[model samples]
Target: MISNNIKIKTQDLNVYYGEKQALFNVNLDIHSKEVTALIGPSGCGKSTFIRCINRMNDVIDICKIDGSIKIDDKEIIDNNVDVVRLRESIGMVFQKPNPFPKSIYDNISYGPSIHGLADNKSDMDKIVENSLKKAALWEEVKDRLDEPGTGLSGGQQQRLCIARAISVNPEVILMDEPCSALDPIATAKIEELIDELKKSYTIVIVTHSMSQAVRVSQRTGFFHLGKIIEVDTTEKIFKNPGNQMTQDYITGRFG
Candidate 1:
């Protein structure tokens, strides 16, 4: 069992897509309420490692993973595990904003409704309000709650997705390049929101942008060729990386 201060810990993790291995002997620790960023070139297994946290790779039939992944000291990859509940506890936001084809109100309310989080209409309303407020979108969308979520602009839609993810009251939020699809202004907004969200939720993000990783993460892990080259404070990772590979990648010497 992990100590209370640690929110997540992975032990010697390995992932395979069919017979081809993508990640090898990956070990990591995530502290509560801190933001951890995974950075690397494409195909370096950064995203794959994050997906393993919540078992999201299960969505792909050929993907197979081996390791002990514990969240708050509970092993989540056990056989007969409740994947639905696991995912509910560990929410996710993707590279692209993917809100339901429903009203803004419905998008926020959907998760709580499905999870029986609210007892009645009034309770449901509160859930929606609180979630939207947490995502920094409530005030803007309050008057237009009935508006279709798709009607929102790109940044607003991404925030809506964040709101929807939080509606489940997750303890950990995994974000995969959440700002890659947005404009500079929208990306800045999301970065600000991420800084705020870290006050409550443990956030793990996979990012291709080194500056984005440096701007938002407390600890950054540099991965290459299915291995984590180094994990340290973001300041050290960028300014004084211990590994030659990490220095090379961050300095634009090579991926």
Candidate 2:
């Protein structure tokens, strides 16, 4: 169930890559324990918007962001913020499943180990098991924990990545088109995982698939040309959007 509490808030958010602006005065509020989906055409800044939540854009030296991003009503855009700790609390799953070449167990244990969430081998073992179970991949790979994560099938590898994300016990999860590379069955499984995960973690997803947004999200924000055109309940956005551009886009008239 979605909480009334706001988990993340952004106001007047703008992004530029060497003077090429990517986002424009974006303002959004994400509710706690809910799936908030961002939908847009290509290059519309959907991915850029979610990346800002975890400060993933900092990797690009040319990128410059100026705005207010608050998590739990605390400013995160400040220079004084501990970025590593912020990222530990917000996990990200990218469009492609890029698991490390290490073993499946290592993949799940890596985050907890780095964060010092476990004291001993036994504690790490429990964290790995629980994370895999949460990701719905434990039964499939429990016997092959020593196998390389890259050895798994694409779907399994993606699940392994998800397990790694949750192993750190993040309060929020950001998925950038997580199902784009997946087959329908795999996509369904991931959607189900999102449904289950929303009970414990706030979720933000960027998707080009409108059906997917409707299926997995409680609230939807429509972005176009680096700006959010409309934001409302998923049902409202799909069935009765206030903006003609949004309606046209949803109806396949134009992107």
Candidate 3:
């Protein structure tokens, strides 16, 4: 069942990169303050779907998006929509930890500085500290704020990227295979952080790890051939999916 507390709504969201349609007539209602995980084999349009939420596909000259993506009923596809503000409202963390070649403190403060969320050093400092604390990295890196972000361990770097995402106080955070490059221990920390983060921010994650999806998300969507074949509570999707294709994919058939 779709929740009444829908934070993001996508209707007939179709994307075409040049001549290839990457997504097909997709409709999804993402709930507020919840983690929704997208799972599928590669090339299933999972990343493309989330990128559409923030209009990231606009960068590609031939990327054509036809449909509606709304946050609180405000259509994001409108030509007049300020993409910078939109992106600030909906932050993204990519597959690998891609930290800027700046100090740890600078990395956390970059978004707030760009969006004018902080006006003074004190406010920026608080924002930086709180964001790191939220990502659970403050304790480890608090004294090393001057160190370059790129120098951190892989897991720490990914957490740093996450802190940067939340630094802007985004309404929603989109993570694309965020833990793919981390070790089991590092992945565990990121997973724990994701669970805690959903209490304050809506989150959407695209991961190939079915176990990760099961562990981190309340609702799970199974995508296949550029479409979502099934979506339901994680338990049901894993153990009792309604679609055979979904069952096949989850059971390690043809995914």
Candidate 4:
């Protein structure tokens, strides 16, 4: 059943790269102001599914997508869509921390500046501070805004990237293996941040860690070989999955 709170919806969604198919009729509904986690083994098309949300797949020369993707009930697969503006409303954080080679201030302010989100220097400064604070890195990096973003430690750099994503005031945030490279403590911090961020933004995360998915998400979707085998509330999916494959994968029997 499709809920009235659905923030993003995909129906009969299919994706391809040249002659190879990456996704197969993926249908998922992400609720507003909630965290939805996608979990699967390697090469299961989990990342491909989220990439389709913001049309990031459009960059690949051979990529072709069909079917329907809607945000706020508006179709986005059409060529007439404003991609730049579409991207502005949907933020993405990648697997690894890939901050620009610029200073922390520039990193956060760049999106707002290009999008004309700030009117003056003071406004930009405020956006930078607020974004960093939201990402829980303001207290740590506030004193060093002029320093290069890449200079921060791994966890701090990841937080900075999160801040950069939120700086543009996106309504939806997509994270693909956001904590894959971080240590345990760093992963916990990111998890905490995700919890807080979901209060204001719709978050979709692709994760390989079952524990992480249970901890951070309200809804969980299990993908296998380019198809979604099951999706349910996180508690139900973890404690008692409806599919045998889901049960096996979560139990370490098979991936």
Please report the candidate that would top lDDT against the real structure: 4
The candidate, 1 or 3, that scores higher on lDDT is: 3
Instruction: Give one digit per residue, the lDDT tens place, for model 2 in 34-129.
Output: 999999889999998998999989999999999999999999998899999999999999899999989999999988988999999999999999
- Each candidate structure's TM-score, on Cα atoms with residue i matched to residue i, is 0.97, 0.98, 0.98, 0.98
Question: Model 4 clash pairs?
Answer: none
Model 4 lDDT on a 0 to 1 scale = 0.95
| 29-85 per-residue lDDT for model 1 (tens digits) | 888888999998899998898888888899999998898889989998787889999
- Say which prediction, candidate 2 or candidate 4, comes out ahead on lDDT: 4
lDDT of each: 0.92, 0.94, 0.93, 0.95
For residues 87-111, what per-residue lDDT tens digits would candidate 3 score against the true structure? 9999899999999999999999888
Give the lDDT of residue 112 in candidate 4.
98
Q: What does the lDDT come to for candidate 1?
A: 0.92
User: What's the ranking of the predictions by lDDT, best on top?
Assistant: 4, 2, 3, 1
Off by over 4 Å in 3: 1-3
Give the winner by TM-score: 2
